[model samples]
Each structure stands twice: as C-alpha cells, then as structure tokens.
Target: MHLLEVRGLGIRNPETGTEWILKDVGFEVGEGEFVTIMGPSGSGKTTLLHLCAGLESPSEGSVFLAGKDLAAMKDRDRTLLRRKWIGFVFQFFHLLPDLTVRENLELPLRLQGEDPAVHEGRIEEILDALELGDLRDRQPHGLSGGEMQRASIARALAGRPPLVLADEPTGNLASRAGEETMRLFREVHRRFGTSILLVTHNPRDAAFGDRVLFLFDGRLDPAHALEGPDLDAASVFARLEELGI
Candidate 1:
C-alpha cells in the first residue's frame, strides 16, 4: 500500500469563500521514498502539508494514509492515527519551552504510552545522529536556531512513524545548518527506511528528495517534477526560472 496518497485534493480558504488555495493536488509517496514539494512563498505549500497530515479538511477530493481515508475518519480517530502514523517537523521548531531537550524528544513516546526507558538506545542513537548530544540537558530557549531544528527533527523521528512530514524544516537556519539538517533527513531515511515528504521553497532543500515536485499558483506543475541528474538543486532552480515561477 502507498504510505500516503492525495487524489484530486482541493482546499479553499473558508474566509475567502470561492477562492481555492489548492486545487486538484494529487500525488503518492510509497514506503521509504523521500518526496519533496517546492514552491514560492504563499504558494500553498504548507496548506498542502496540513491537508496531508489530516490537520485540516480539504474542501474537495481526498487524502489517504496507509489505505485509510482521512476525510472519512472522525476527528478523534484522525488524531489517534496521526499520533500513531505521522511525525511532523515544522519550520518554527515547535519545542516545548518548559521541557528539557531530552524531555522534548521523549514527549511523543510518552504520548503513545511507550516507556522512554525502553527506548534509551534509540534515543541515544538519534542524539548521536543529529549531533545533539551536547544540547540534551538544555531547554529550547537555550539552543541556537539550527540546534532547535535538529532537536525538532529528532523528536519527529524518535517515534519511528511510518511517514514524516516536514514543512520548511530548514527554512529558519543558516545555509550550512540547513544543509546539515537535510543530511540528517536523508540519513534517517537510509538507516530506518522511513518515508519523508518535505515541502520547501529552497531548491537546495528540494534536491535531497528522491522526487522533486514544484508547486506554484495553487497547482503542482508536472513540467517541474524532476529526477536523475535533472533532480539537482541547480536544475530545479533553472527550471523555476525557465517557467517564470
């Protein structure tokens, strides 16, 4: 089964009535594949992510995750499914202020009624992988922007969810840090067979994915989806320029 699928998905801004933010967006990500969606600012990239996560209802069409239809499920069931199946990394690094880095990383496991003690080996592995060992005892407020983002990604992966949804995860970091963050995503995918769906405007960020999709003006442009040598960052940016996107 596909890890995630979107069929003719459309989302309209409730406040705006007739205007559609995303229209007829459709795609699928199979198990262990890394897929990216790139778009300009305000191009509905985050909105599409929200729809995939079942955090918002689409005005039309459907989203299915692991063969379960999101629009057909009750809100509580959707919440449970999300807890069990989806790990999300946000651009803003939504760490809890009162929780220590260790605590923050353990929060998802705790929510799922899993004991952190049993996951110590895995947690240590993540800390080492993300190079976050030094920041374990610190609070979110004490870390640099890149450090916080790394912690956020670690937290998302700690649960070993089948699919990870990242919305501009590196958008807040410096170029080097952002590149490092993308490397971590690739590493996790390679080591654990995790499926990742990342959305960002940055071409460098999009290049890391197995498949690259470009979204603009509320539509996913097929002409811009890239693979092979054409999937590099330079190629993606060049396509964007060629398309006047």
Candidate 2:
C-alpha cells in the first residue's frame, strides 16, 4: 500500500523569483517502509518533507497522503489529518523550554483532546522504552543534545501516528548518539510497523533506511537506491559528492 504519493511536485520561493527550490519531484512511500532522502545542504530536502506534512503547499502538482489530496483540504482539515496520521521529528529539537519532558510529550495528545486516563499506560511504556523515565521531570534546556533529540522523538511517537517524517534526526548528535537514535528508529518500525521518511545529508544515515533515495537538484535518482554490500559508507558518500553535497 502507498502511504504517500507525490506527483510532479514543484516549489518555488516567491522572494527569489529565479528558480524552483523543488522541481518535478515525485515518489511513493509504501506502507511500513523506511526511506531516506539524501542531498546537499540547501537542496530542498527539508522543503520536500514540509510539503509531505502539508506544512507548505506545493507551487504545482499534487501531494497525496494515504489516498487523500492534501492540496484540496482546507488548512484546518489538513492540520487535523496530519495530527491523526503523521508525526514529525525535526533536526533541531523543538521542545518547549518551559515544559518538563513529560509535559512536552503529553502536549500533542492534550491538543487532540485525548483522554489522559486512556493514554497514561502508553505514556509510561514510551518513557520506559525510550529510557526517558529518569529525565521526565527535567526541562529541555537542561538536557544534553542527545537527550533532547530522544525526547523530541518520543513526543512524535506519543500519538502512534502511522507515518513519521524525520528531518536530519541525528544531525546534532555525536557518532555514537546518532547510531543509537537510528537503532531506536529501527526498533520503532519493528514494533509499530510505522512508515518513516527520513531526510539527511549524511550517507552514514542512509544505512538505516530500507531504501536510499539520492535527491539531486530536487529530483530522485532511483538508479542509486542502496541495497546489501552496495550501501557502504564510501559508496554513499561518493554519491553525495557526485550530487555536489
């Protein structure tokens, strides 16, 4: 089943007036598949994720999430759809400084008017699974970068959304921390069968995905999809360099 479908998508910055940030981009993500989008910085990788999540409308073409046309929905309806089916983990942890880790994790459910009694057990399970129980009372500002990133991911998963859009999820972490986060992502996929679209410039990160997509000038090069021994770090980096990343 196709969870996401983007056809001939194009996005342009009205301010630049010169070029399309994303042009003629198209792809489909199957149910429960982990897909990595790789490109150089400023190559519209993040822009594509934003479009997938309906945070921004494409300048042309269509974005369909779970068979629904995102472009045809009003802003309020789009937001509600995203809340019910999509989760996002951004490069920079966007936790609120004033809220404790537990509060931050609970905010999404609160906004959706989910009953606290029904989710309390699930919340505890997630905290324990993410190793965040001890830091539940801590504020985001007090935690290390890795911890903050983990908490951000925990919050995204709190609602158990079917599709996850992660933007450079390990960008701020050290090598070990990054690998740990990737393991967590894999665990989430195995346990929940959630589909993920992860955007990253780092080839090392591509190893986590079932399919790696090379995005150059906002277009996917399907010929470069990685598998088995072909997914070595050297090969991945070489491809990124070829794309001028």
Candidate 3:
C-alpha cells in the first residue's frame, strides 16, 4: 500500500460562494519515495500538504495513511497516528522560540513516547546527520536562518516518521542555504528510506524529487507530472515555463 494517499480531496472557502480552495485533489506517495509538488502562491500547495498531514480535514473526500482513512480514525487514534507516522517541516522554521534546539527535538520525541537516550536511535542519528550537535543548546533566535531550518528539519525527522510533509522547506532562506537544505532533504531520504511529499515554487527544489507534480489554481492534473532520469533543474524549469507557472 502507498505510505500516503490523498483521494479526491477538496476544501471550500466557507465565507465565499462555493469557491474551492482545493478542488478534487488526489495523489499518492509510496514508501521510500520523494515526491515534490510545485505551484505558485495561492495554488493550494500548502493546503494540500496540510490535508495530507492531517493538519486540516478536507471539506470533501478523505486522506489515508498506511491504508487507514484519516477522516475515519478516532481523534486520539488520529493524533497518535500523526505523531508516529507523519513529520512536518514548514517554510518558516516553526521552532518554539524559547526552546533550545535539543529541547525542540526532545519535545516531539517525548510526545511520540520515544526515549531520547535510546543510544544510536533516531534523535542521535538525525543530530549527527544534520550537523546540529554543536548548536543543540542554542535557542531558535540564536541560529542563522539555515541553522534554524536544519533544526526544524531535524525535529521533523528525529522520530523517524515514515512520511515527511514539507511546505516550502526552502522558501525563507538565501539561495545557498536553500540549496543546502534541499540537498539535506535528499540525503535524509537516502539514508533513512523515508517517504517525502514536499511543496514548493522553486524548480531547483522540485528537481531533487524522484518525481514532480504541478498544481495550478487549486487544481492538479496528473498529466502534468514530470519524472524520469532526465528530471533535473533545467528540465523542471522548462516544464515550468511551458506551463507558464
């Protein structure tokens, strides 16, 4: 079964007249795969990512993770499922301002019921992988934009969740840092065998994915997918140009 499945998902702006923020969106992410969704602002990229992550419930259809429908699970069960199965990384490193980097990582681990002292466990592995050992004690404000982003990514992956949902993971950083962050994501997928669904407007970010999907004005077209060994930044840019994205 796919690690994550979004089926005919749709959400409406309750304040408006039948306006759909996301209209019948659907997709799947398989185990150990990296998929990127690219779209312009207001194209429903983050909204779709949130729906898949269970951060929001769709007004239409359902989302399934590990074969269980998100809309069907009980509140507690869904909470537990999300804590253990899904990881989230946002554009603005949503780290708690007062918490140290280590504490930020620890908070989720604790919530997930994983002992931080499990030696050679996910926390340790991720810390080493993200090179955050020395910055672990620093508060969020003390770190560079890149460092804070790395810490946020580390927090997302520290529990070794099967699926990581990222919304504009590189959107707030300088170009070099953004590139580094994207590379880190690629490496994390390779080293941990985790599935990823990332949404972004940057072609460079989309190029790192095993496959790419384009979203246009809250609508997704499967025919717009770009995938292959030739899926590089240049190809992604060309496709974006062709689509006038």
Candidate 4:
C-alpha cells in the first residue's frame, strides 16, 4: 500500500470563502520513496506540507496516510496518527532553548509516552549516527546552525516513523552546511529506508530525492515532473528558470 496519498485536495479559507491555497491536487507516495517538491514563493508549498502532515484539513478531498483517511479522522485521532507515522523537520531547528541535545532528541519519544530507558539505545544511535554525540550536553544556543539542523533531523528520525516530512530544512544554513544536511538526509534514507517528502526551492536539495515535482500557483505542474536521468540539479534549475520561478 502507498505510504501517503492525496486525492482531489483543495484548501479554501472558510471565513472569506474566496482565498484558496490549493486546488485539485492529487498524488501518492509509495513506501520508502523520497520525493521533493519545488515551487516559487507564495505557491502553497508549506500549506501542502501541512496538509500532508495532517495538521490541516482540506476543503474538498481526502488525504490518506498509511491507508487511513486523515481528513475524516478526528483531531485527536489525527494527532495520534501523526505521532505514529510522521516525523517533521522544519526550516528552523525549533529545539527548545532550555533543552540539551539529548533532551531535544528525546522529546518526541517522551511526548508519545514511550519510556526513555527502553528507547535509550535508539536515541544514542541517532546521536552517534548524526555526529552530534560530542555536543549532546549542549543546548541549542551553544551549537552551530549545521549542528542544530542535524540535531533536528536526528530528533525527527528518532521515532523511526515510516515517513518524514521536511520543509525547507536547509533554508537556514549556509551553502556548505546545506549540502551536508542534504547528504545526511540521503544517508539516513539509505540506512533506514524511510520515505521522505521535502519541499524546497533549492535545486541541490531537490536533487537528493528520487523524483522532483514542481508546484505553481497552488497546483502541481504535472507536465514538468522529472525523475530518473531527467532529474538532477542542473535540470531542476533549468526548469525553474524556464518557469520564471
């Protein structure tokens, strides 16, 4: 079964009944697939990511995560589903300022009511794998941008969720740091076989995915979806230029 699916998805402002952020969008992500979405600013990329994460409900269609209808589920149920199946990495680290690296990485498990003692090995594994072990006792303010983003990625994967959603994860980092972050993501995907759906404007970041999709004016431009040999940083950049994005 598909790990994620969206059918005829649309989002409209309920109050104004005029503003629509998305319309007639449909797609499916299979198990262990990595997909990247590229779009210009104000094209609803973040909104689409939120919908996929079950944080927002669609006005006219359905979103299915792991074969269950997210739009039809209650808020409580959706929250549970998100905890169980989704891991999120945002543009900003969003780590609690007061928490140490280890503490930040442990937050997701603690939120899910999982015992830290039982999952301690997993936490350590993530820290070591992400090369954040040396900074484990340090708080976010003490770390570099790359280190913080790495910690954020590690925290997101600590749960071993089937799917990970990243929104502009490299946005806050420098070029070299951004490249390292994308490399880390690729390595994680290889090692864990986790599916990733990321939204970014950077062609280099988008090239890490198995397929590249373009979004324009709240809709996915089906004609420009590129994969295999056709999907690369150069091609993505070229396409972006062509689209005036």
Backbone clashes in each candidate structure, one number apiece?
0, 0, 0, 0
Candidate 4: where are CA atoms >4 Å away? none
Which candidate comes out best when scored by lDDT?
1
Over the stretch 1-245, how does candidate 2's per-residue lDDT look in tens digits?
Answer: 58999999999886896689888888889998998888778888999999999999888999999889999999999999999989899889899999999999998898899865689988887787778999999999999888898899889988989999999999989989898888888888887788999998888887788888888787776776775656667778787677665
TM-score of 3: 0.96
Candidate lDDT scores, in order, read 0.92, 0.87, 0.90, 0.89
For residue 59, model 1's alpha carbon misses the true position, in angstroms, by 0.7
Model 3: lDDT to the true structure: 0.90
| lDDT tens digits by residue: candidate 1, 1-245 | 99999999998888988899999888899998999998999999999999999998999999999999998899999999998889999999999999999999999999999999999999999898888999999999989898999999889988889999999999999999899889999998998788999999999999999999989889985666887855788888898898798
Q: For each candidate, what TM-score against the reference?
A: 0.97, 0.93, 0.96, 0.96
Candidate 3 backbone collisions, by pair: none
Every model: Cα RMSD to truth: 1.1, 1.7, 1.3, 1.3
Q: Against the true structure, whose TM-score is highest? A: 1
The weakest ten consecutive residues by lDDT in model 4 span 221-230
The C-alpha stretches of model 2 lying farther than 4 A from their native spots are 228-230, 241-245
**Pairs clashing in candidate 4?**
none
